[model samples]
Target chain A: MKRSNRLVVLTDFFLENPRKHIQLPYFVTICETTKSSISEDLDIINEVFQNQGMGYLQRSTGAGGGVKYIPAFSRENSMQFIEELRKKLEDPARILPGGYLYMSDLLGDPRTVREIGRVFASAFSKVKIDVIVTVATKGIPLAYAVASFLNVPVVIARRDPKVTEGSSVSINYVSGSSRKIQTMVLPKRSLEEGANVCIIDDFMKAGGTITGMINLLAEFDARVQAIGVLAEADDEEEERVINNYTSLVKITNVDIRHNKIEIQSGNYVENHTDS
Target chain B: MKRSNRLVVLTDFFLENPRKHIQLPYFVTICETTKSSISEDLDIINEVFQNQGMGYLQRSTGAGGGVKYIPAFSRENSMQFIEELRKKLEDPARILPGGYLYMSDLLGDPRTVREIGRVFASAFSKVKIDVIVTVATKGIPLAYAVASFLNVPVVIARRDPKVTEGSSVSINYVSGSSRKIQTMVLPKRSLEEGANVCIIDDFMKAGGTITGMINLLAEFDARVQAIGVLAEADDEEEERVINNYTSLVKITNVDIRHNKIEIQSGNYVENHTDS
Candidate 1:
């Protein structure tokens, strides 16, 4: 294979199988190269990244060890990237029933999830975001991705309170989709009073959950520094409650029955300049 | 400061604040250098990592864009690193009250958590692990870390079933630390029948949760290809129920009262030949 093709194959392997604990023989097998050749490829790839002023590749020298990436990339750049991503999301296929916008795939992809987190982290680099608040399930990974980058704790605001969560403060907010009341809660002490809070969610249609999160933060006497959403549906009817929040992507409409999707950039990533 | 020192400070910032979206100006501010100087440092550092086959450093050319590390380090190396980590745990200080091991710090650390995930992902590179399994809270991140690397979904086994999860498959097992009967459950269809499985946790004391996961996998007729842990306390008890696991660090013992901690190489890492 040509050198470029070989590099592509290596990158494909790296992205597909993200193990840093395999033995050298295994990598040699995967790359269909000798141990020494694999090492040389690694060296070249590592060199390419290092020369770029990005994060370095790490190697474990012991049993079942191999290589891993320590990204040295800028989070600020990620925010700008999100702006581009937001523009792409202008398609209309993401809207769901009940004013909900689907964003599971975005949260599931490591690259995209990391980008979203990086953008938020960059946006709040100078500010204090003591906690990341999101409703359960779809929002968990986004919360995790952001929390992971921020090195702070993430408090999941569940629609249904669990006894396991101990004592929690809850708020009844209108569900944007159904216009029905839904309750969201957080541990009473999850955030401190006057804490600077950043709220995140996977999608926003009516922003009910986001509003609930805003209320929960207020219950703790916390201030909302910013709110971020992966995608926001841009239908005029859905805007009944959205105010002063940022969305990375905007979906104009979706036809699940017809399998159509539309999305674009939301105002947040577009308006927010790189720091 | 010298270039090397400057790089260290910059790298440390990335490590310290994983949550912040990074930018050139931020680097310039921290290093007290010109944006151009910081850019040069970033290039040098990025080059070093790339040359070493460590990982890739990605750069975007725009006013708002800068550099960030997109780790593509090998999974094989991560698995080997975990083996080394396991060797470290054979020591005694890791043991804590009720035969538990303290590892909140490692679990909470972005670098360590990411590395730990890479370790398991490396181990299960060839295996088709449909779902990464773990108990609630602390294990959630580990499960996420491994899943992030493998590009697989993670399923958290709740100690008790809640309405949020809908229908779940419940199981009874002994606690790894307490060795008492406990119930854990997974949402129905969380693990497909006959799906390949890789179990992960923060610490393995009695291996009870691991055992429980094994049972839960069996309930779904899922195959548990291998098990991995962040740390394993060397229990005085005879015969561990599970085996073929990997860990990053080993706690031989811990004197929490005196605030003393001990760690060393784990067997998982030591067994590698470094090829």
Candidate 2:
């Protein structure tokens, strides 16, 4: 294959298989080129990736060493996306009857959801994650999106357990906004013992759901490496149960009668800018 | 930017934004090159993509003329993947007590799910799809995966409606295996009227759930362009509710006492091979 062809194919491979390491010889064989030429191709790809604020290729030396693509959204890009999301959320039509904002459309959008996933994945890029855990229904898409970029599997926690899943571990916790007790269950075999986990959800109210997930992870002896939500409600009346998490947007206020909604950029930008 | 860098960037863009049309002038501006050079670059990328069985670029001429990337998996690649999946599903360990198979792990794995999505998307590449619809819980990931490759949005149908989603249209249908009445709901605003939709799900037993989804789409006056499932049960006893659809694998047999399971490649290959 020619250099131009090799560059296109290699770039597609890296984007599709992020965080995966491959030996140099494999690329050389596929490209029908020498190791030195392949190395030069990697250099050019890495330079373009970094220059475009996409990410850089991390290369290691030695017998067992190779190259891995570390996907990261630049700080500028992350903030800009968050800001755009915040503005989109501020639309009056999003306000529901009970001061709830309708965000299912955004979550359902593949491009938007993938972009949100990219932001969260970029935010927690430094953290090691074995698998992504999320609750059923709404959180499933966001979880899978982040898992795709992180190159990990996703284990979903459901409100009801099915016979097909075999045995499971269930936990009951108070719903943050509803203040009603609900059950969350995960299949026993779904996660391995002592695995590192990253929790992802579509929305966060007072963090009770996330806390329940944390407690659920305890049963398997898994460590909570990180937690991320697409949006978080800024409720002054209710006490926040969970801290140390990343959110892309914060819902400040919602007035149903006036059809008004207020949204702002979440703490992801602030935390990531410093790093 | 140089030709090598342009190749990498263009490849990444096409892969990330499949099915999106881009004009030659846009590429020229981004690559800092002449239109002729950008045209040559696109031809190189398209040739490499087609040669690798990834996909090819479709170009048009005239006022609205542009290039669009149609991501596809060749029949050879699709059949190979389905065969591998069939063999994987034949494991006795995957059998549960009630002759059910445990497939959450496969559904949770991003790579596997994405590949499955690619097969389905490629199968329906000729069909025009405005949106992909799926029921809540298990099907969300597959729906999102397919939607990602098709460059379309996803709308989920849930068993129960949430306050944040506003008013919804609900339908009661009989379960295929359980033979019990159940409700399925989709938000009224989630989908537009007269949309070209593709339905996706993780598994199908007697196709009751899919039938319910099809009926529900009728209420919105939307057209069901295509349907795809990861797996389907080849039950001799029950009558299948759906006849027109694509599946990647078929669960042929299961014996709980013997801890044995049997699977085979689905009809996707036969239908696609002739085309």
Candidate 3:
């Protein structure tokens, strides 16, 4: 294959298989080129990727060394996306009854969801995540999206037990907003013992659901490496139960009667800057 | 930008934005090259994509003309993937107590789910789909995976109504397997009127859940363009409620006593061959 053809093929491979390490000899064979030429191709691809603020290729040398694409969104890009998301959430039309903000549309959009996933993945890029754990229904998409970029599997916890999942471990926790008790279940076989887990969700209010997930993970002896939410409600009335998490946007206020909403960039931006 | 650099950026763009159309001028400006150079670059990328059985770029002329990447899987590649999936399903240990297959692992794997999504997206490559619809839980990931390839949004139907979604349309239908009535809800704002939809699910048995989704879509005046399931049960004891659907694999038999399971390629392969 020519250099041009190799570049296309190599770029596609890297994008599709992020964080997947492949030996230089493998690429050389596929590209029908020498190892030195393949190394040069990697350099060009890496340079372009970094210049575009996408990510860079991590290369290792020696007997067990190769290259893998580390997908990290630049700080500028992440903040830009978050600003756009905050504006979208600030729309007064999103105000629902009972002071709720309607955000299903944003979560339903593949592009938007993937972008959010990219931001969260970038936020936790340094964490060693063995698997992404999320509750079923809304958070599943975000979990899978982040998992795709991280090259990891996702295990979803469900509210109701299903016969198909075999034996499961169930935990009951208090709902943050409603103050009602709810049950969360995860199949015993879904996760391995001591697996590092990253929890993802669409929204967080008082952090009860996330706390519940943490308690559920305890049953399997899984370690909670990170927690991420697309949006978090900043209501002072309700005591926040969990801390030390990353959020893309914060809903400081939602006045249903006045038909107004307020949103701001979440802790992710501040944390990113501090780091 | 040079042709080598252009290939990397263009390939990444096409892969990320699968079905988005961009005018030739737009590419020329981004690549810092003339229209002729951009055209040559597209041709080279398209040729490599087609030769690898990945997909081809669709181009048009005139003022409203542009290029879009239509992702498709070749029959050979699709069959090869399905064969691997079938073998994986045939594992006796996947059998649960009630003869249900424990496929959450496969569904949880991003690569496997994405490949399954690619196969389904290619299967319905000709259909005019506006959005992909799925019921909450297991199907959400598959729906998003397919929507990512199809470049459409996803609307999820849930069993319970949430206050955050605002008003919703609810429908009651008899679940084919249980022969019990169940309610499915979709936020009224999630979908527009007369929208074309593709239904995706993780599994089908007696087609009850899918049938319920079809009935639910009717409430929104949505058109069901296609239905794709990762797996379908071929139990002779239970009558199948749906026929006009595509399945990747059919679970013909699951003998709990003998710890045996039989899986075969679904109608997708046969339909593709016939076409």
TM of each candidate vs. truth: 0.54, 0.99, 0.98
Error of 2 at A267 (Å): 0.7
Instruction: Report the interface RMSD that candidate 3 achieves against the true structure, in angstroms.
Output: 0.6
Off by over 4 Å in 2: none
Per-residue lDDT of candidate 1, residues A110-159 (tens digit) = 55676677666655655667767777756666776776656666666777
DockQ top scorer: 2
Order of quality (DockQ): 2, 3, 1
Q: What lDDT tens digits, residue by residue, belong to model 2 across residues B7-126?
A: 998999899899999888898888899988888999999999988888899999899788999998888888888998999899899988789999999999999989999899889989
How does model 2 score on DockQ? 0.94
- Give the CAPRI class of candidate 2: high
Off by over 4 Å in 1: A1-102, A148-153, A158-175, A178-190, A234-242, B1-112, B118-138, B148-197, B201-223, B230-275
DockQ of 1: 0.06
lDDT leader: 3
**CA lDDT of B138 in candidate 1?**
60
**lDDT (C-alpha) at residue A94 in model 3:** 92
- Per-residue accuracy of model 1 over B1-275 as CA lDDT, tens digit each: 44544655554444323223466777777667788887777676565545433444567777778766544345456555555555544344544444445343344445566777766565565566676777775676777777776666777777766443446789898885655798988877456788887888877766778888888878888888767776676777756777677765666666656655566656566643322
